[model samples]
Target: VNCNCDYGCPCQFNARPTDGTCRAVVAWRIDSGHFGDTRLDGLHAVNIYAWPGAIHEGNGSMQSIIDERASDAQRTALVAILQGEGADPGAVMLQIYRTMCTAAHEPLYEPIHLDIDIAERTARLSIPGLVDSAVEPIRNPVTGAPHRARVDLPFGKEFRLAEVASGRTRATGVIPLELANT
Candidate 1:
């Protein structure tokens, strides 16, 4: 998920909230999987982003953007999973967005550009004006030091532990996302 938050999101600090809310865009490329018994392969991605006033608040908004190449069946499968279904309970993205979102933007069909190098803590996710985000490491302002931080969730959804860094963000859609090098 590519998110637009104040550099290091407050959620990591166990503090209040970022941007006084949570505004983010999440997209995943399913290299291999299945919704029930239906095969879900050949690069399937969805953008589920939101703006939450607080971690537990329930009045923000969200949008889901899908790949245009997906067929009707594949689209439905991906949308269902993204819309807070078939996932585990209290999974941060799904549950949080479903309850807090007030408005639901229509799902979009467009080509999504995605790249990742977890070992190097690097990733690039692009969806045109809707989203263009990149994540890298956080560097010192004065000494120009490179700082690194990481969050690990043993049984948590998404990734186990992601290296969090400062990143750049640019968005033209309702959902906002920012990225930086950690």
Candidate 2:
């Protein structure tokens, strides 16, 4: 998730979004996964979305992008999963988010660039014309040293735990998402 949430990301724990609203950039690099017979391995999926109030508030909008390298079966499966169409009700984070969205723009198929460095607490993901986001270690304002932190979600839905850090996102497409220092 790369939208405009605070550094602590209150929304991760069922709390209100830091900005009184939610703008989320959900992305993934599926090195290995599957949707039934469709091998979704080596695929990338990204979704940009926004809501006026909390996530519980419906009528939101979204734009999805998938790896163009995917085959027909892979594309269809990925899109359906991203749209939360072929899953058990509320089973995953995407499924829940799908129920809250009202408008889904036409999906984009394009090459994706993704890099993840977990030990360094850094990542970079870009979908041309849609979003450009980066995550890095949080810095100490006074000393300018990299601040270290982590969040351990023992019973989490999206992730079991996360390395807390500073992040920024610039979304210039239909979703219009933006996040800074978080």
Candidate 3:
């Protein structure tokens, strides 16, 4: 969730985004999954996005990057899923987001690197020539000790549970994304 939102994002609570605009670099690291016959284990993906105002207001742009390690079948399947064509309608947020966006770029293939520690609220996700992003535990402003927090939502669109942390990201793509302290 490396987005252009302030720490403790208001969107989580149905409030407006801090800056009244929305753009982000979201990702998924598939530890294990299957797309029909092709195995998607150890694959990674990124979705870069930009929006005019509030997300629900519509009008946005999107770009995607998929791991090059995947086979042609895997790539096709992944692209379909990203375009909200491979899943049950309205089952996932991508379906709705895909509809709101005005543009979706051609997917890029690259070697992805990802290391995630959910408990530690940390991750490093990179796609060469596309994006570099990292998340880490927030630090106490006063004592400088590691601060830990978690977001729990019984009916959240993004996740039912998530660790809260500080993050940084810079992306190079058709829909460029840049944010810090996300």
Candidate 4:
């Protein structure tokens, strides 16, 4: 996930953004998972979002992208899950994010390449003409050495623990985004 915020996004702590607005590009690589009986393994997806104000204030726009290698059935199932269908209210991050956005652009089926290593605090995501993003360990301002940090949300819906690293993203789509060191 890359967004226009300082390292350690304030939103994770329920605080206002570093700036007044919000723009983000997030990608997910499903190593192994299942949506009911559907085998959702080795698939990737990306979401782009922007808002004029805080997320809860509404009037946001979003675009979804799915891996082209998925089968028809896999695509349908992934779309449903992305749209928050059949899930209990606010049970998932995608579901909650969808409700906050007013404009939902048509989803794109395209080639996606993603690699993530949580322990190493490294990641790379590419969607051809859509986006190019990467993540790496934060560096110490004085020593220029890799600085490691983490965030743990005991009851958070998005993730239980996340390695806090620097992220950069450039996206060109319905909801464009350009973020650096965030």
lDDT of 4 by residue, 40-129 (tens): 899998888998887878788988898999998889888888878887888887888888899989989999999988767799998889
- How many pairs of residues collide in model 3? 0
Judging by lDDT against the true structure, name the best candidate: 4
Q: Which stretch of 10 consecutive residues in model 1 shows the poorest summed lDDT?
A: 173-182
- Model 3 residue pairs with clashes: none
- For candidate 1, the per-residue lDDT at 122 reads 69
lDDT of 3 at 148: 88
Candidate 2 per-residue C-alpha lDDT over 1-182 given as tens digits, one digit per residue, 9 for 90 to 100: 67677876787778888878888787788988999887898788898888887888887888789998999899999999898887798798788888888888999998888888877878899878767999888899999999998789898877887777788899888778668887
lDDT of 1 by residue, 1-182 (tens): 54556554666656666557666656677778988876778664755555556646677777788877888887887777767777667765675567566777777778888887767766687887777777666677888776677777786444577777766656677665544431
User: lDDT by residue for model 3 over 85-146, one digit each (tens)?
Assistant: 86576788888788888888889999989899876778999888878999999999999988
lDDT of each: 0.67, 0.84, 0.86, 0.87
Could you tell me every candidate's TM-score relative to the true structure?
0.80, 0.92, 0.94, 0.94
Over the full model, what C-alpha lDDT does candidate 2 score relative to the true structure? 0.84
After superposition, candidate 4 runs with Cα above 4 Å error: none
TM-score of 1: 0.80
